[model samples]
Target chain A: MSLCVLEKVSKTYTTGDLVVYALRQVDLTIDPGEFVAVMGPSGSGKTTLMNILGCLDVPSSGRYALAGKDVTAMDDDELSRMRSEHIGFIFQSFHLLPYATALENVLLPTLYLERPVDGGKSRALELLSLVGLEDRAHFRPNQLSGGQQQRVAIARALMNDPELVLADEPTGALDTTTAAGIMRLLSSLNERGKTIVVVTHDPEVAAYARRVIRMRDGVPTEQPSGRTPRPLTAHPPVTP
Target chain B: MRRFISSLHQALKAVRAFKLRAVFCIASVALGISAITVIVAATEGAYRRAYEMVDRFGPDAMLVLGGSAEARAIGRRDKTITVQDVEALRQAFPTAYLLVPMSSVREVNISYGNRRHQTRVTGTTEGYSRSWSWPVVDGRDLSEADVKGMRNVALIGAQVARELFANTDPIGKFFFVRNVAVRVVGVLEERGTTGAGHNLDDRIVMPITTAMKKLMNEKTYVNAVRIRFLDARNMGRYRQEVRAFLRQRHGLKPGQPDDFRLLSSEEIIRFLVALTGSLVIFIGITGVMALVVAGFVLANLFLLSVSERSGEIGIRRAVGARRRDILFQFLLEAIALTLVGGLLGFVLGVAAGPLLKLAADFPIYFSWKAFAAGLILSMLVGLIFGLQPARRAAAVHPIQAIRSG
Candidate 1:
């Protein structure tokens, strides 16, 4: 079964007299252990699509299934439980609690679950080490560099060993080198049999994903793939 | 329970983070509570002392005195209360076990050689001591022989002894009451001053016969007659019998008003008790108003704290704390603060009671009930005042809060 499937999903937001169509008849399927990137311009409904897939929001109409269980009609508490158990989110702004230490921040997800997974602390520490932040476990978010804070956010996202990892412009605010480092960490997590979905406007960041789906005006378009074109030997060079 | 403990600990930690503000809040509440405690304790002490003094006078004793109107209409021509009235009352009422005619001569100058002072002198029969329950501290009381013989003897109070003797023994000494010499046979024990601040132990007692025959010249009627009933439950019967006897002795018609007034010690005590109760209630209401103001101050302080710590509350809620949890946390902070303040005020009030007594020149007693009331009232105030701010804290939206941060 696919990890997440959205069929004919739509989302609309009404602010006063104007109605905004954030998503229109969106259809997608993501399988286990796959890396996909969603690229679009600002206001092209990428974040809205991400929010729907992460269960932070519901589509106005249609079916959303996670691991073959229909979740579009779930209540608020059920959705929170689903987020706690099945989904992990990383935001570009690195939303870490300012007062908590890095380790405490990572422990937050497991606290919401009804019961902690075995060896929760050790798992949290292992995830911190996975992101190369094991030495900064006791430091608060304010004391860390932006790159380190983003790495801690990534570590916190994996605290519950979630099946699907969603990154919304994970390195949008970082330097090129730090962004490359984050992309590499995400790629490594994808290699470890975790399904990864990243939404970004940066083509270079999208290059690291195995599959890239481009979005335009709240719709997705598939691109031709799978074969490398033959090199035209010398004749095509400078013909003009 | 463990969660409650941790929550309380966090509440206290939050208060401790801002020490000066917490101290200011506590001190304001303490001042109000202490004021209430002092008033309640002093009022209770005064009532207790008044009751003790009333109890010292005999339980079933009643006073029959000439009324002002009757004394005026007679114009010294008709006798109001006299030795004959006492004799008649004793004869008419077998229930009247002890009837003594007594009169007071205020501002009488007494002298013993060089020492001279003005004092009140009360003349009564030997039954006066037993009827009034006044204990003789030293020497001997007046005897029937002294009364019949009209002997020149007197019993002085504690203050008179201190003033005239200057630590010397006063028994067997001779003192002159308005130029008439009298022998001192006994000294009364020191009875504390009355609720009205009259010194009960600052007077001299003389035999009625001697006081009437020698100093006062036996020419005037007596001031009043004190009667004691055999059984206190028969007081009404005794009162009726005395009224009838006075009417017959004075030859009054059925429609004519009685010549004298009859009052019981119980009646006087009841009046005084009611007065004290009203005073206590008045003072209590004032204290409650102050407490309410303190409660408002506390509410304002907590509201300010909630506003200042909105970010912290947002963080806690985001970390899986329920709305009820947040409310309890803030309420716990308020209750803890006020409870500490209440206890401190109780301790200070108790310690200050003696000093208050010295300042007011009256006795003050510590009461646990008042302390308990202060503590409970303070906690109740905290709970009531804390509700609004706690609810506000609980209602903060986590999503909006996070976005703002």
Candidate 2:
């Protein structure tokens, strides 16, 4: 079964007498173990599409399914559960709680679980180490550099061990070298059988994916990635 | 359960992050709770004082005053009950255990070896000790010889002993009242202060014969007469009979208001409760107002933080926190703040007993019931005011995690 299936999903915003179509009957699908990039300019409805794909929001019309379960008909509570159990989201700004340490941020999802995961503490520490932030687990967001803060956020995104990872401009706040390092990490996770979807307007970021979906004026067109695919375990040129 | 604890932990961290504002919020809750505690303490003290006084006065006792209470309120002073009235009462109540007559001069300067103290000086018979339920801690009680021979001997109250003697022993000491010298033969036990702040232990008592001969000069009228009966169940019947007998003895005409008043333990309790009723009610109103004001301060405090922490709320929701979780977090914050205030107020209220005693002779006592009630009341205030802030916190859109700061 597909990891996520969106059929003619539409989202509209109504303000006073004006109606704006953020997403106009956009249909998309994400299969397991696939790396896809969604490229769109500002106001192209890419954020709204990503929100629906990640189950952070529901569509105004049409159907959305995640892991074989319908999502558009789910209430806010079920949407929260779907996001927690099946998908992980990463934002460009990191969105780390200012008062929480890196480890605490990683453990945050466990707090909302029906029964918080046993050995979750060790798993949080392991994820931090995987993101090269083991030593910074006790540090708050402000104490870390931008790259290090993003690394902490990435570790938190992986803490729940979700199969689908959704990132929205994950490297937008980082330098070119740091952005490349983050893309490499996402690439490595994709190779480990995680279905990854990255949203960005930058072609450089989109080039890392195997398939590219470009959105123009609320319309999406599919294309084969320009670069040849590397082996599943193949190492790319990476920087820390 | 873990989620609830996590929410509480988050609430504590939020409060700790901005301690100055937390203090501002807690002040109103503490003020209201402290006032509540004081009111409870005052009320407890009033009833407790009445109970103790009634016990000392005895259940089967009736006290007849020389003037009517209603008339005294309008500044009417009647010197109607005289020595002859006491003799008449003794004859009327043949089953009475004791009948004692007393006359006291308030605010008299008494001196011993240049150490001076002002106190009430009372003149009474030898049965004064038995009738008042007062016992001597030092020396001996007044004997029949003292009243019959009109000796210049006296018994000192606890407070008068403390003031005049300090570290010196009061027994065998000589104190003078208006140039009439009397040697103290005994020191009375400590009786503390009354509910109205009257120091019951601040007086000197001497034989009526000595006071009449040396100080009063005219010995015809006395201030009050006390009679103790054999059975407490018959006090109501006895009270009526005594009223009729006194009126007849005084030749009081029908419809002409009797110039004297009769009192019992029940009457004393009613008067005391009535006297402290206004004070208790005033404190109660202020206490409730304080709680209400504190609730607003707390609600406003949480509201401000909810808006300020919108980003944080969004992050939490995105990480899978349900609306109930967000609601719990804010509710926990409110309850935690008010509980701290309740604790502070309870401690201050308990300590106020000693402090107030030293400052104003305020009667107070510690009651766990009142403390528990205050705690419950404070928690209620938190729940009532916490709803709006928690709901607002939960209403924060999860999309803010990607958008807002």
Expressed as tens digits, the lDDT of each residue in B1-405 for candidate 2 is 888999999888877777876797777888888888888877788788888889988888888998876778798776679999898888878988889888888888889888888888888888888887889889999988998999999999989988888988878877898788899999888988765679899999999888877877857988898889999899999999999998998898999887899999989789778866877798789999989999999988889888888878877887788889999998888888888889887887777658866886666777886798779888888899988999999988888645875
Question: CA shift at A221, candidate 2, in angstroms?
Answer: 2.8
Against the native complex, each candidate's DockQ, computed on alpha carbons, is 0.14, 0.56
Give the root-mean-square deviation of each candidate in angstroms. Answer: 7.8, 5.9
Question: Which lDDT tens digits does candidate 1 get at residues A53-92?
Answer: 8776688987899877788998755666777788887877
lDDT of 1 by residue, B49-164 (tens): 76676677666888888754566565753337877777767787787778888877888899887998889998888887777778788999878888888889999999999888
Worst 10 residues of 2 chain B by lDDT: B353-362
> For model 1, what is the error of residue A173's alpha carbon versus the real structure, in angstroms, after optimal superposition?
8.1
TM-score for each model: 0.70, 0.81
For model 2, state the Cα shift of residue B237 in Å. Answer: 8.3
Best by DockQ: 2
DockQ of 1: 0.14
The fnat of each candidate, in order, is 0.05, 0.64
